[model samples]
Target: MAEPILKVENLKKYFPVRRGLLGALRGEPQRFVRAVDGVSFEVYKQQVFALVGESGCGKTTTGKLVMKLLEPTDGKIYLEGQDVTELRTKEEIKAYRRRVQMIFQDPFSSMNPRFRIYDILEEPLLIHGIGETRAEREELIYKALEMVKITPPEDYVNRFPHMLSGGQRQRVAIARALILNPTFIVADEPVSMLDVSIRAEILELMKELKEKMGVTYLYITHDLSTARYFADWIAVMYLGRIVEMGPAKEVIDNPLHPYTRALLAAVPEPIPERKDVIKEIPIKGEVPSAVNVPPGCRFHPRCVYFKEGLCDKKEPQLVEYSHNHWVECHLAGKI
Candidate 1:
């Protein structure tokens, strides 16, 4: 296999827990929220790799770390085998930004409401010094809009973000990301805010763009259904750790980890024959706080097959169970 376009090794991000003055006076030990605790994944060229879990599972933080928006607490990130953490200077970061971009979840909020669509699209080009003149920039902006299927760019380019529909706005957001022709894009639940009917459309467009432009994606979302459709790989995160990861189809079809099975069981099936056929992988309790993750397996508290000592006394290491399939559970294949 070819080398991965993006690689993250044991990536960690720990945000310090805020302490009030009284607590500070007591000299209590400083605690931290282990948002992204020892996450590691590799995204190949043009592949859509998804990080999926419940809200606050640190998927977004992972995306930000990849995009260089947030600094890592420990570990390394490599872009095309170059250590991304080493690029700290403003010029180096600016150069990296040109090769990497983000497609935010809320398109409207990410855009400047006061700026017209054209200006918004032109911002990246200006920062990167792509086009020498207004005419050249306009041509590139129009081409980007066309690439995103927002044809007749003139019709929408001059309008404000509020004027476009949710789907159209999302297309514009994608267009903005593409304007610089980034090598990797961090799409943070790009379609969660859109209507269900439009979700497939946006995903299809993104997939199409990948084929046409060779852009890889770090797709962050909680929806398993979409991940099954849009991603080539899926990593199930639980309390800042990946519990199961493998090819999208394989993981969805035959989940080894109890947590992965439980997640799949909750997904709504549309076929009449399978409508009530929930797999019923029993899970208990709410997700534990990130500030104090479970001692052993993070999902053991909610897992149905958790063993008393084995699952609670020691953390499980991610191990390969099948062809390219990995699970971090004490009873990965036992269940």
Candidate 2:
């Protein structure tokens, strides 16, 4: 796969839960919230590998871990074959950050309202010491703005975050990420907050950027439809675990895991007959608390085809069912 730009193995992030005063007096054991648990995946150079699941399924947490925004409790993260997870020195982290960039979910929240668009874009280059002179920085800023399709860059360059629409603000965010000329990007639901029509425009811009710049993307989204459209490969996540992964079209057209099938069924279909053909696998009940996960397979409690003994007692390993297709489900081979 052209030597993966990023590789994550058994990544886990656990947030501690403090006990109450009384429990502390009794010496209660520390409890942890497993935000991301043992997630393993790879992003090949220039490939858009998406991690998708319902909100709080650890997709965003996984993205943060990959970006090193959150320190993992266990496992390793390798960037360009270097073990970035253990890099403690400031200079090492700074160098790692330059190669890997993140595009947050909320454009409004991520952007600084106080700064002008030019300042926002230039800050990264200045921090990274990319362009030396004012003229050089200005040139890079304009190029970045234009790269994200904010035409006649000068018009939008001096404007503040409040001056632009949701979509325009997001373009600026993307431009900021691209200014560093990063090889890998973690786009965490980049289009979820924008208008429906504007979402397509932003996604198209990302696709173009990948082609022109050879940028690899870890596109994290709950929207299976958009994942199907933008990603070269798709990984179906459920309860902090990847239930299925394969080529985007193969996964969408012929889903293997029950959770994957359920996600695709929820996506609105255009044709009436096709809609009927797509069975709606109603995911009953809420997602189980990560602290006290189900016994065997995490999805067993909510899975429709779940058998009492097997699914509830045996954890399933991700196994290859066909060429390039992998699924983690008890019924994968049986079906």
Q: Report residue 121 deviation for candidate 1 (angstroms).
A: 0.4
Instruction: Give me the runs in candidate 1 sitting further than 4 Å from their true place.
Output: 271-281
Count of clashes in candidate 2: 0
Candidate 2, 244: how far from true, in Å?
A: 0.7
Q: Which has the greatest lDDT? A: 1
**TM-score of decoy 2:** 0.96
Expressed as tens digits, the lDDT of each residue in 154-203 for candidate 2 is 99988999999999999999999999999899999999999999899999
> Which residue pairs collide, candidate 2?
none
Reference-based lDDT, residue 330, model 1: 86
Q: Which candidate achieves the best TM-score against the true structure?
A: 1
